[model samples]
Target: MPDFDFTALRRFPDVEADNLFAYDASDHLILDEAADDLHAAAPGEVVVIGDRYGALTLGALALHDAADIRTHQDSYTGELALQNNAAATGVTGFRSLDLGEELLTGSRVVLMQMPKSLSELDEVAETIARFADPSVTVFAGGRLKHMSIAMNEVLGRHFGDVRASLGRQKSRVIRARDPRPSAESAWPQRAYLDELGLWVVAHGAAFAGPKLDLGTRELLRHLDEMNPDARTAVDLGCGTGLLATALARTRPELAVLATDTSAAAVASTRATAEANEVAITVRRDDGLSQQPDACADLVLLNPPFHTGSTVHAGVALRLFEEAARVLKPGGELWTVYNSHLTYRPALYRIVGGTRQVSRTPKFTVTVSTAR
Candidate 1:
């Protein structure tokens, strides 16, 4: 087998900055370990989970010559990158599905990039255990800094055996087999936020889990003060659809769109809206790049400061630009962010006139109108 071409991959649609990288050593480690498993399994029987930017999936297809590969990526941007890389490299015959039975059913081999959250690992473990072939072997890899004893415990709960491979380049792969098929799932967790009088459902991979983050809680305080005539609104970067649900409940006449980059967040938001009996459109998007200009009457955002494990403001700024594009003239963008970030100036320059709506010790809520 030849070496995989890392240069063929790119992280467009996601934040592409100097500090943040596209592929990592763990990707190579997992694909290498899964090579034997891939050979033993039938074509189209191999499942790739948590593949970031086509590394594990494309590498297997391009290098090992594996075909009919199925994949599940958590982030919308990651999926887009995989498609872009596949088009660029002229690789085809791979199917991408959400984290469900369609992606995991009857898979004898699984190559996964271990997620940062143990609960997310648990979600993957239980789903594969229940849905995949009973004899499936899972090759899960991650950097040593991100791996934990708790992850082994999480895997052990679903798999009969779990063992770690030798660490190379500060990365390690954990192989597990003999899945316990009867294991229960803990995902799509539900919790009631009494303060907001709303219930939120979150998948394990959703940001901030099932609880309301301080920034969002502060932002929700002013929901009643929104424009009375506002008919269309967006919960930009909506996580678990907390604000969307709140807005729907407060103003039942408004049409709300809840959008996020993470597939888990989109699914969680849909579940949350259904749980709260609120009607909203939930979608996975690369910010609002797909939205038409001046399509929304208002935009609400609790922008994320991190892309993957690295802290960067580029992700938030990208969303700000998208919001500015989506909102109509005189329309408003309500944003909640950490006080220390001091994003008011950027909001003013990027969107329009920005004014502090509310400020607390930890978070500041601001409203910027589309100029």
Candidate 2:
């Protein structure tokens, strides 16, 4: 099969807008601004982040030799798109890693794709600051909506000196020159709930940040009731690993498999497991590709409905089908999604039975079982 290409969305002004095969010709912000800066960068061992759909990572990897440098990633889709685009483009040498993974302790340049969460960006900047200096040139791009005076403050706080390029096609790029080294914190460990108290593993990405989401909080409630007597169970789309953590907490006798598309999420779960001192299997997987057929007793999912600009049922539908494929007869999938999604019809077709267990104004939970 041909390598999957990422489809670009408008308004997420980013440094790697055009590197994607699915580039939006209509992209009018950071794409143009970042393109100009990238052309002038003398690349070697550069780390790129927030490359939504992976234009910047692809560019850095293809533009530089791996022996000279490496590119790291943390965005969920960014990793997926980066590997896909790399294979399709026949680009080699560069390996994709997550922020939750070890960061560039020796990277010379950092190319950042600003995220929607300014707090996240601040965290990234602080992480890089530990190793950044005047020798480290940080180049970043974003849309007008995100490019603000406040952003400059964050940049200044982490890196000493900064400048920006003129907006081209509504895009702007900031150049931060780090003169003095910034203090680095020990990587924060992921926290998992357990009898041991707190599980903490230093993860540098989006997975096990400070708090848990509401959907996962609700899903965690049913984990104790889940039949763990089966040989194996999987927590699909485990974010921050709260679901996986509960599974491990309740079923000390079973080896719980935890998986997610996000590298950070996977690492966080692993960290959570370690911090809680609970033993569970964790991996980065697209849906349940790594699972064996008829192997799981339960597949827990809080499936996301969209990726960037695309809002479709593709993710949820795939998880359901994959759950059925890997589930033994009578095995079930317990999942949650926004209440607005019409998932019942899709669930009925994928599983033998679909039951609505609970709902809120914004989200709903369903239990699907195979006959």
Candidate 3:
């Protein structure tokens, strides 16, 4: 085993802008705190989930001689970053997978970066407990600021015993043991939205979790004014397929495509679309990378404001660029964003002919036409 260098890691295609960082204190603390436990696990028995870059997976490989570790990263960019880091460092034998039986089966030790959402944590704990080896031990770490007693409660729902570590560097790790295999999973959860009369389905890692985000809610109000006669529409960065489903239901003649970078988001969108009885083509893609150029006449976007925990605009800007490329000449790109982010200028520059469709206290809705 060799000493690993954390500074060499990068978060390309994720967020590398100023005022935001690639890795965090929790990433290092998780590996360091679980060093002894990880060392004791067999080479092939370690699993990592939510590793932001390659910190946990690569660290285990380089420092503990843990080989063939199975990992699941919800974000496509995070997975790519892990691959790039592994290639750069010459580490091998780690497998990247979606959260499922294949990723967890027979694993004895699981390392996790605690998710910000309690539903996400619930899904991870349930899947790990139900699919992994009965004796598997889980170490979930996160910054103390984000950590909550609710996380432990979620873990307790799936595992028999849960314990916490003393905070170090404002980060802490929660350990859960004694899996409860029969626990009912709360993931791929289905909830009915009374306001829209729509059923939204979401996997744990999906953003907003089957609920209408305020921005998307604001955008939905203006969907009727969009190019209704357009043949093709896209829900770019469609988290939970709320926009796509709304569009499909409102305009049944339109062919809608829902694309997201997160595997979980893609799955959730697909589920949401199906649950709502709406037809949509859903794909796990980096922005609109899988869509042909100028193929869409209308594109709907509710771009995310954060990369991990940092409020960064890189993702929103990238999505805007991709939406511009995906929309045909004279097509329209409808967007809703935080009012303070002031995405109007970027929309005008990237998509052209920007106009404010609606604005509320928290969000601003804009329509940009493709020149």
- Predicted model with the maximum TM-score: 1
Candidate 1 local lDDT, 1-371, one digit each (tens)? 66667876788868887777779999989988888877677788889999889988888887776779999999888999999988988877698898889998889989999998887888888899989988899999999998898989999999999999999999999999998975456788999988888888999898889999887888888898776679999999898889999998898999999999889899999999999898999888989877899999889999988888778999899999999999999999999999899799999999999999888789999999899
lDDT of 2 by residue, 2-102 (tens): 23233422222112323323343223233343444445444444666666655655544443332333556554445666666666666555566545325
Superior candidate under TM-score, 2 versus 3: 3
lDDT against the true structure, per candidate, is 0.89, 0.65, 0.87
- The lDDT leader among the candidates is 1
Q: Measure candidate 3: CA RMSD.
A: 1.7
Candidate 3 lDDT by residue in tens digits, 79-140:
88899988888888799887999999889999999987887888888899999998888989
The C-alpha stretches of model 2 lying farther than 4 A from their native spots are 1-21, 24-43, 60-69, 75-77, 98-106, 145-150, 179-182, 186-204
lDDT, residue 123, candidate 1: 86
What clash count goes with each model?
0, 12, 0
- Candidate 3 TM-score, true structure as reference: 0.95
CA lDDT, candidate 1, residue 343:
94
What TM-score would you give candidate 2 relative to the actual structure?
0.79
